[model samples]
Target: MEYRVLLAESDRSMLERLCQVVDDTPNFTLAAKFQNVSDALGQGAVFNPNLILLDIEQPGGMGLVDAFKKVYPAASILCMGDKWQAESASGSIKAGAKGYIIKPFSGVELQESVDAFSRLGSDGSAEILVFFSPKGKSGKTTLIANLAMSLARKSGEPVGIIDADLQFGDMAVFFNLAAQTTIVEAVRDIRFLSPASLSSYYMPVAPNVSVLCGTRTPNMIDKVAIDKLENLIAMSRGLFRYILIDVPAGFNPTSIAAAEASNTTFLVSMINGAYEIDHMKRALHIFRDWEDMENRAKVIFTRVEPCDAQARLELSQKLGYPVTEIIPNDYAIVSDAADKGKMATDIRPDSPLSRQVDRLADNIIGRKHRIRWAGV
Candidate 1:
């Protein structure tokens, strides 16, 4: 199917060159091009393009990322900007960009971005996965680590895991590596980001798994704005088959923005505590109004002990939502693996807990397989 795309760039020469490239590509047609944010927003729902090419800095002093979301909900935006000014790329993704291409990028990068968006199903593929929890000690990091491993192993596709929990993130500790490059550094050079540059910033944990750890100091988090986080995820989407975000535990703007930017927001919780349950309920309430939640909010019950069966049932019943998956409490296995910087599934592939994780991975992949019945 042919895609009608809108291009918004302040550089006339660059815009024209990009247009020529798009024209050369099969299955894509330039529906329109705007020089500024005002013009693009004013056109509104009329151009009705399937994809958008947006500039980070446009006229009218308003961020192009913010305008695109309000103006074109159906169009998946691809953001572009200069390296120094590329900080706005993240903002664009938070505002709903499908992918981001930094300035000084090539036709190949542009084409690849377009192709990635095109392959998405009518339901909108989940190129980015954001996992968040409102309360601390809720096993957010572990979930992120395991889920990333699960996705990599099951899909046989590269997965990029970002520990967005800047202040207290322990993803590096879990991986047994000192974080050298972070999302902050990547955002600083947003303009230079391409498929090739992205690999340099990401620390490879496995053949198909890479991680971008958070800052060591809490103060460093201030350097990262909502837009940068969004842009980072957008760029990652183009590089990895899946981008999993491990968010800090809170309702801050950063967390909210991450939730908004994600294709699926996994609210991880445990069944033992009333505080966790109540917090999960409040989070659900908060997210129900979020623009992305119409089909994306999933409550995953983690660290489930066998004795907590009743509470789990009550929690599911009270929430009126199916628990997507119940990760059993296996502290010995989880802690040991985390300490050794190994994935639990890798260490205990035959364990029942690992089987549950495999099942979760299968469900996420949405595959169909035959089932045989001995007696029917």
Candidate 2:
């Protein structure tokens, strides 16, 4: 199919560059080019454009999305800007734009943005969440499962779970999914895959939720490079609305990389271990230097007896770091859900454990998370 692109930009240099680039791209035709929004709106229809690259930074530029739609209803309008602007990207999407891209972006970037953002219903970015545990048996996997379920149910969008434990991830076992391909295959083939093709590697375990299972054997962990895993997560952002990564327990490269990539990192510990608080304290001190560590990284303690505000405050005071949330634990419900291949939220939605997870899901969506690291 031919992509007859109409370009509108206030900057003359950018307009020329976009016109040249679009004309040079495969299957792309520079239907028309203009230095301002009004000209595009006035004459864009004559081009019969199926794709439009519009600058959203100029005065009255963003407001033309609806007009462009009215003029060329068949065109896929991609908003462009001088730099990253969340409000602009969101507003363009809300105003019927297919996606947003930066100025001087290549044809590959342009196509990728449109294809990826189209996955979301009037949204652009995904919530990359990292669930970290100081050690194994922190109930992090269970937390991911229930929270993912809640998120999927509430949003009715695709949620991705990447079991990055490398050695002993139980995501497939918990979901009762027999993986035909695991992270190993994904990493091996990642260099040759696109968002749509890579999606085939993930197994659909629940409605609107998919799991990229870990290696079939512990030794296969070596095949799953940390860089590749991060790249996999990056590529997945285009595909999933909410991506929950279950990193290996402890502060290894995989865990650190995942945490750094995520907008929110849930640093989880449980009451079963007496040393958990100390471990959490150590992790907090290490993470303090990271940008917005105080905000993006949440301190959570599981299996607490009280699981109250007082407990959170006391623990926060004890650790010299704010305790963000707590989970009330009853092994029975979690185990029962796992045994039945169902979600804890599905089994006991009103249970304390499930309720806390539901609240967490809400927080993930409702909370304002800073998307970029500062001083970049």
Candidate 3:
């Protein structure tokens, strides 16, 4: 499908250069170009381009971000300016740009940004998947790492995995990413969060797969409120095709908030552990009480050994929840991939375990002919 783009820059020469580059790109057409933010805002509603390339610093020193957002809320805006002007970049994001490309960037960079925005239009709502377990060592991080890559690979779309486990999250370790930025920093400036600012906090782990690692300090958890978390997830729905949130164990405020914000909550557990069963029951009880959560909860049994069929049956019967998918106890493959900081989907795409992950992705994206596990 052809994409219509609106390029808005006060600099006439730069606008011409960007137009030329957009013309050369495949499946993209420049619907309009404006030398001032006012002109862009005046025509935005009528033109209604699918994507917008906006300049933060324009004539009259007016906040172009605010004006354009007021006019066109659906168009994905790409903020352009000097990278050092972080405040302006942040402001533009707060005003509702989907992504941002710094000034002096290559033509390739502009083309890629446009392409990402174009893909967003195809996926109606960005699919967000949150992975949470009752406690640590339940393979939540491992599952998320593999699942993020698998979803991206299978669907050929952008996928984001967030380590919402505020304290003691190991998502970065599992992916070999340095924990430089955390959701803590992003939430601190929650007022400025939009697609562009959200994109700035992400660390790309693989092609079309990015991660938002959790904060290291427990105190940082208090910095992120439920509303901020919900807003972040809501804004993310515009940029990503799939989002996997790696939630912390136990029913704390953050975990509860994450569960509420997610479209589907995969209550993960393991077989042969009475504590796991008890935790699952407690989670169910909590979900049952919350009037808003009854429809969005599903039980996913992880690390199930073939010999533990009886235990699995008892657990499923007791909880009255269908065991959506039983991930086999394959520590060798899971642990090796985790230790090496490589995704299992990348290492063993043809393996039984990999096939299971693929199936899980299909279920999450609503591609398979199975019953809807959650209302969403």
Expressed as tens digits, the lDDT of each residue in 1-376 for candidate 3 is 5668898888888889888877877777889998877777786567768777887766643366666767777666778875524345435555666556666455566665565666765323565566667766776677778888888887788898778888788788888888678888777765654455567788998998988888877777887887777767765665688888987787887787777767778888766556777778777777785565544677777777662447457657877766666677778888788777797778878766777777777777663225674322
Better of 2 and 3 by TM-score: 2
TM-score of each model, paired residue for residue: 0.68, 0.74, 0.69
Off by over 4 Å in 1: 1-126, 291-294, 307-312, 367-376
What local distance difference test score does each model get?
0.72, 0.82, 0.72
Off by over 4 Å in 2: 1-45, 48-50, 53-116, 368-376
Name the runs in model 3 displaced over 4 angstroms.
Answer: 1-116, 289-295, 307-314, 367-376
Model 2 C-alpha lDDT per residue in residues 310-364, reported as the tens digit of each score: 8878888888887777899778998898899998899999999988888777776
Could you give candidate 1's per-residue lDDT for residues 31-148 as a string of tens digits?
Answer: 8877665777787458688788777655642366666777777677777766533345445545566666666556566666666555442222346778888787877688778878
TM-score of 2: 0.74
Ranking by TM-score: 2, 3, 1
On a 0 to 100 scale, what is the lDDT of residue 369 in model 1?
27
Could you tell which candidate, 1 or 2, scores higher by lDDT? 2
Count clashing residue pairs per candidate: 3, 0, 5
